[model samples]
Target: MRDVIEGFLTFQQEIYPNRLELFKKLAEAQSPKALFISCSDSRVVLEMLTQQGPGDLFVIRNAGNIVPPYGPEPGGVTATVEYAVAALHVTDIVVMGHSNCGAMKAIAAGQPLDNMPAVSHWLRYSDSAKAVNEAREYGSADEKLNALVHDNVYAQIANLKTHPTVALALDQGQLDLHGWVYDIEAGVIDALDGPSRTFVPLAENTKVSALSTKLG
Candidate 1:
């Protein structure tokens, strides 16, 4: 708690002043173009990874980076998505999954969650990912984890599409969806292509350039 407080104090004293002009501009309004969804992992710092500053990415984070299919039961993830699409009108939604995700590990290992009911319930959102892993013919644990991470990203993208606002925006060609897997060890991001239905290096996709421009 003290560390966090000092971190904020340091930000206010030093970082805020360095970006005062940008902060002042954002004080008026924001027009961020991308909704970045990722795990609540300490290593997955979206802003630092993308080199984005204040008012850049509208980010939604949770365990496993999961997005449950839209339902009548209200939840924070759903509400955030609704606001990002219906209100903010973000042009793209990027669902990022990273290597060595603790949530995914727990899900894959079927670790007894008797003491962590909420975590067990939240991870149900990745049932599709589990099914994908079970059906794969991978020989090693690393390969299985990699496949699970990528498949989970794809599954969450499909789940994101289930949102009415996202559906409308996509149908109107006003929004784009992306699935990304970040290799934490290698410091690389592989983006999934909707049309090709395959993961490719982020640099190989010219759409990332357009997204940068839109976000800027």
Candidate 2:
């Protein structure tokens, strides 16, 4: 807590003054271009990874980077998605998963979560990912884990589409969806190529439209 307080104080003393003008502009309102959904892992810093400043990307984060399918009892994730789409009109939504995800490890190992009921319940969102792994053969545990990470991103993208606002935006061609897997060890990001249906390194030359298809 002390560390966080000091950090904020440092920001106020140093960073904020330098960026005061930008902050003033942002204070009025925001028009973020993307809705970035990612894992709640401490290591997955979306803004830092994307080099985006405040007001650039609207982000939603949860354990496992999960987006629960839309239903009558709308949760925070659903509400945020609706707002980003209907109100903010974000042009893109990026669902990012990372290597060595604790949530994926928990799902794969089936670790007893008797003491962590909430975590166990929240992870149920990855059921489709688990099923995908169970039905396929992987060369090794690492490969399987990597596959699970990718599959989870894809799964969440599908779940995102179930939202009415997302559905409408997609139909009108006003929005785009993306799935990405970031390798922590390698410090590289693989953007899922929807047409080729494979992960590729993010490069300036990479055509985003080629990777916009719904992930399997």
Q: Evaluated with TM-score, which candidate comes out highest?
A: 2
Inter-residue clash pairs, candidate 2? none
Score every model by TM-score: 0.91, 0.93
lDDT by residue for model 2 (104-193), tens: 988877789999998898888889889988799988887888889988988888788798999988888888888888898899988877
Q: Give one digit per residue, the lDDT tens place, for model 1 in 82-149.
A: 99999999988899999999998887677899999988999888999899888878778777888888
Per-model lDDT: 0.86, 0.86
Q: Deviation in angstroms for 160 in model 2?
A: 1.1
After superposition, candidate 1 runs with Cα above 4 Å error:
208-216
